[model samples]
Target: MNLETLKQGRNYCKSLTLNDRKILEEMLEDDFYIKFHELFRYMIDEDLKLEQEWFG
Candidate 1:
């Protein structure tokens, strides 16, 4: 997720019930970009698709 999606997901998850948040948090951890330092390095394409694993 990008900065916006990360923030939005956090807010959205906050509004969810505990059970839902538990699942959502796990999902986010599995895929969200928690490390900004490695963002550019890990990014696959510069069409700015940071969500993808670097293929470049």
Candidate 2:
């Protein structure tokens, strides 16, 4: 999920019990960006290139 979804989930957790909220918080705390960055770095090292035409 994205940052906005995390924020909304956190707000929703406010009404939950402390233990339940903590469980959800821990589950949501994975560092997704680091994993994504590593994937991008691997692609770059493998000579992957993006073309504007691909987007259009």
Task: Provide the overall lDDT of each model, using Cα atoms, as 2-decimal numbers.
Answer: 0.37, 0.39
Model 1, TM vs. native: 0.28
Instruction: Report the CA-based lDDT of candidate 1 relative to the real structure.
Output: 0.37
Q: What are the per-residue Cα lDDT tens digits for candidate 2 across 1-56? A: 33333333442322334564454445445565553444334333433323223332
Identify the candidate with maximal TM-score: 1
lDDT of 1 by residue, 1-56 (tens): 55454333432322334564455445446545445434322221121332223222
Question: lDDT, candidate 1, residue 19?
Answer: 62
Clashing pairs in 2: none
How large an RMSD does model 1 have?
12.3
Q: Which candidate is the best by lDDT?
A: 2
